[model samples]
Target: MPLLKVLRPTLPILVGASIMLTLGMGLRQSLGIFLQPLTRDIGISVSDFTLAVAVQNLAWGFLQPMAGALTVRYGFRPVMMIGSVFNVIGLALMAMAHGLTSIIIGGGILIGIALACTASAIAMSVSARAVPATVRSTVLGMVSAAGSLGSLLAAPIGQVLSEDYGWRAGLAGFVVLSILMIPAAWYAGRVDRVPLPKTSGDEIGNTSAGVAVKAAFSNASFLVMTCAYMVCGMQLVFLTTHLPSYLAICGMDPMLSAQTLGVIGGFNVLGSLFFGWAGGRWNKLMLLGMIYVSRSLILAWYFMLPPTPASTLLFGALMGFLWLGVGPLVAGAVAEMFGLRWQAMIQGLAFMSHQLGSFLGAYGGGLIYDALGSYTMAWRIGVALGLAFGIIQIAFALIRPLSPPPVLKAA
Candidate 1:
């Protein structure tokens, strides 16, 4: 069937999913723009601020499985709608923050909880459930590509507002953008009505969540992918949380950081589309390994060179292309490896590892920077670990192809 023909009926659901994802992720990713000003104005150190971000990742990581499980019990609407409200409250708290306590509560805890309900894992699940398997990967890429637009818009807007008005004003702008998520989540919640497809393995969807968890853990391929996902989280979070400070420390123009992030968002569109398409036809895990390897190489290249506008923007483009491409591949792989019924919960298991790495990236980079007055050690460690794991991921994926999805004994 033609792509449009397949999507036309479900257009509203996909669009809502995309918008919810875009705003949720874009705003979160762009939060790094406020780090310097927020910390300075609040009389906190860089590490203190990043500690909140690290906490956010930890909260988001740990809570994701619970949220996914809730979606199974209640529905995506209630989970996502409540998250949208949390997003508003969180951003409002960040805007009015007087101290680290407020920042951690609003930005760290609230936003983290919001993300559990609203971001990539849930968004991809919604998209996967709404579309047919034949074009599932391709559609996931499209949704992810749309999601990339958030950072592109959010970064520039927040930066301009912060530069002219103040950091509070920038967060306020984000709050306004976040309000749109409520309705998006509602529309996206419609997926709850879409029945799971009956297939030979339809019984897989009927398994208890506990049974599903056991099955997922027993799969070796799933385990390797989960481990490798940690490295992915580490590298990406380090950049989002630290890249601005790195550029500023180099005496580059302040706007340059936002611009670089925007460039990343723009290029992310192309990368997401390409990877999404590529995933359907190729081995998804191998593609993931390749993205990791490419990202590490790119990180090494950019960090090694002296700062320049052209170099920074080019670096953003390269990195952006590799960025959210992970969304489609990971989500699609999980759905294929398991089944859609528990897809969100299972994927959340892997994301917990990713978020652990994110915690390390955000907080760890700040610690290194505060101690050494440079990102030299941080980037080196990131590059080294990324390469090692990327290679391992590739090798394991090739040697041990994914076994068939687990089958529970007759009850």
Candidate 2:
């Protein structure tokens, strides 16, 4: 009752955004489950398949700013509706594909574009506009947690479908689920009707989107945060894309890999919530620094320990707790610094940098494994990058409060 009472004002936006994230991110997270099966069926190397998936990440990042601009101008519903169509079509194409070309076109290009529209950037942007500033971080966290729930549920479900019927059927089933996002998109579009408060003279409200972009690009803190997000993207995609394969390579049961992903998803739910609450109450940049530092330490411990079911589960649980927790904090920081007038566009650019990292992590893991016959090099690189980024984040914490940019008048 207390929770409901607190959320009642923004419940629709929260529910709609959560559902959209659930289907959008859930399906994306489940792609790892398809790695072995799809490759086996198509007779392609893991590197090839990974390259396609990497393309998907790149495309997602490439299109993010466009999607944000569209959402800002036309509202979220139409963008979501079109995105749902792209997802359904893309999944169907992936199901029918017999070669890497088709897979890249379907899974990489179309689905990548679809995710740009349906993913957290749009969800957070709309939710930020709909909710009061006081509770924005919490709502963003709730939405992210919902997406994690999708990640949790999708792995096992995809495994079951792939194991029972076939991987193709599994993709088809996801197509059905993706269609559900259309309605959710419609519901989330209602945020456009909820008027946002006008910004004070000091805010960037009077400036053009071009000016806001220039200001964010010029801000040292924003630049640092964007760079830090690159590490987040790389680490996240590497784990999501390769964890199952890594477990299989270690001679663990395939099912355990799926379960590990599910575990991560489960823990991510709590992690996102906790980080969300903490972001509101404490220094968010410091929280990010700690998260990266913890990730480096966790990976070290995981490598040191023997690969077993218990170790794998523990790793997943710990990693899951850190998963996606940065999202709300990053979005909240952007809102705090820049205001919401161009929040979507600015955040979209930051996320684009994240996707660049995703591109490297996802594709590079496969390339390394193919070349070296193990993921050792890739994991080691992640550890080093995590530590370096962690320190960089802490340094950012020392920066003074950002001064708002000059407001350029619109023609």
Candidate 3:
């Protein structure tokens, strides 16, 4: 199909969304590098910095549904522009963070909200609309891979900046990068919305954005997808934030830490793309089940692996391959069952669950470490949760998608 005169080609929209996501997540992940440094600078405990990051993660989860709703209502242009502004403000405040309040509100909450707006929910929706279903997964993976690209850069760069410059200066680098997203988002909004495919599931119909969100929350399949995603967030945020520090304290080299992290990012591109393809070719619920089960195994091995470069590389590669595939898988599933007309909002609500998980991951990991004086316990908890989540997801795949809720006429 030809690009709409007013809308850009789907390719550009995907590219734009990818750029925004990469920077947003890349910069956020880099905060782990600064976790100890920033806390020490402000004379606060790790708990304080963790709390701020936790708030940010939770806020992103809570706000995603709202951002998705707005995207459905007004188009992605204005909403993405708003997200860009939030990024600049949040990064600026984070760079100047001198107290807990500054860190929590500016660094944490604002950034989370921005991520909800521009991350997978925004990017995948655009990709789903633009490409044929046959290749949509590949395109979606490509977009997500861009985020890993950012993660690849953020670590070493963040370490260098924080070590040679200061945490504030390092954060300022993200601030400058974030400012460039404004126009890119505007272009993304111009893509024409694609019609949803016909399937055995309920017939997706046109509805006001408000009605769509209301109905999505009430729908059973959407709920299952959302709930499953919540755990994904928790696992991710907790691991990313605390892993390096734990490794370092265990007598590991700093270079190994960075390399392991970078390797994860590199392998994740493969995971994201493979999962995207799997979503289209097979059942989404089953794919999720497999991913989670594999995660449980990976966590088990990761805990057993001694602190060393070889083990670190192997673990990083394994986990990275499993990361971020959830976004495309879940988002594509929602779009598949409910249709695409209200996708932005419905997908956003589901992503909120992810944000909540992220909150737990960051804050809970920090809390566990502080309380135990070791990450051994934290790693054990992760293994249990992964197994439990895998079982729950396997059960979820057995049911058929429920019908969309009865549409109400306007009063």
Candidate 4:
């Protein structure tokens, strides 16, 4: 009854938001499948191709807050619709690209802007505002799970398209699929019109955008959360951008590599949902700490064990389950601490930190491999950072939430 009550009002918005997230994140995750083909065809080195993806990650971070601010000002509809258009354009350009410049322009700049508009940060912000506080984490987690679903479906489709028809055709197919987000964007924006509950302190209705942003940045919990989120981005991007190639180097079949990624996506659905539910009842910070610790352990075990199909799938499943599990908890914590007044903007700032990590992870993996002629060092670095971030999050659990800032008086 409680779940039904929460779902009644928010279901439509959640579905719409999830669809947008699914398309955006799904396409992004499938990019790893293209690396070898794209590089071989373009006659560029792996490092050069990955640099463009790294630039895309940087551009996404740089533009996220700006996109969030725009969504705050103009509402989610226009921002998401415009972003969907950019997605089509970006994919189309990438399909036609033959050089680094075009790849950077299309994949890095355009698609980066598109992701800022359409990714989980914006979706979670909208969902947080639409749902009752009781079900907020569940809704956020479900949206994250939906994104994993996208990756699950897209991975195989992308692999098939790329292998059979060339990477260009695969990208073009994504362009067609991206058009569906236009209507979802329109429906998702409708939630913005929903009235906010009147609550004391920093409820969505009580605070202005400027005040909320200021308060969020000034809060120690948010800053620590943002730092930990950066590590999440690093791990995620590095794996998504390079995992297939890494598997290839380890003597795995290409099809098996794609299948492994798909398996990761599949398991992530359960992981996100479980973490989302757990976030409601458990210590969110501790849960985040565990997720990072799990990642480090998984990576360590992966390298320690022999590289084989069964072992690879097991690793993929473990990693997938932990992959985006941190997302809902982080978003839920932000909403709990800051309220939903400018949730999109504040969450965007946190996601910007994530994207910054993504830039380094995606680009740095390529750089390390190019110089060292192996990805072993990069994997080692991921293990170290994961352990460090896990400790940082546990330390953060000791800090109390900051008191809300004083409301300014009129002259």
Full-model lDDT for every candidate? 0.92, 0.84, 0.75, 0.83
Worst 10 residues of 4 by lDDT: 402-411
- Predicted model with the maximum TM-score: 1
Candidates ranked by lDDT: 1, 2, 4, 3
> Mind giving the per-residue lDDT tens digits that candidate 3 earns over 1-411?
232332344667777777777777777776777776788888877778889889888787788778877766677778888888898899899889888888988878888778777777887777677666566655676677776777787767767777688878878877887787777777666654544454322344555666666777766666776777777777777777887787778888665666777787888888887887777688787788788888878888878867677877888899999987776787677766666666777787787777777777788888888998877877777778777877778787876533444442221
Measured on C-alpha atoms, candidate 2 has an lDDT of 0.84
Which is the leading candidate under lDDT? 1
Per-residue CA lDDT of candidate 4, range 50-94, in tens?
888888888888788788788767888889889888988888888
> What is candidate 2's lDDT per residue for 151-223, written digit by digit as tens?
6777888888899999998888888888888888888888888876553222676567787788788777788
lDDT of 3: 0.75
Write one digit per residue (lDDT tens) for candidate 1, span 355-375. 999999999999999999899
On TM-score, the stronger of 2 and 3 is 2
Model 2 sits at a Cα RMSD from the real structure of: 2.1
Give the candidates in order of TM-score, highest first.
1, 2, 4, 3
Task: lDDT for model 4, please.
Answer: 0.83
Off by over 4 Å in 2: 1-3, 198-202, 401-411
What are the per-model C-alpha RMSD values against the true structure? 1.3, 2.1, 3.5, 2.2
TM-scores, in order shown?
Answer: 0.98, 0.95, 0.90, 0.95
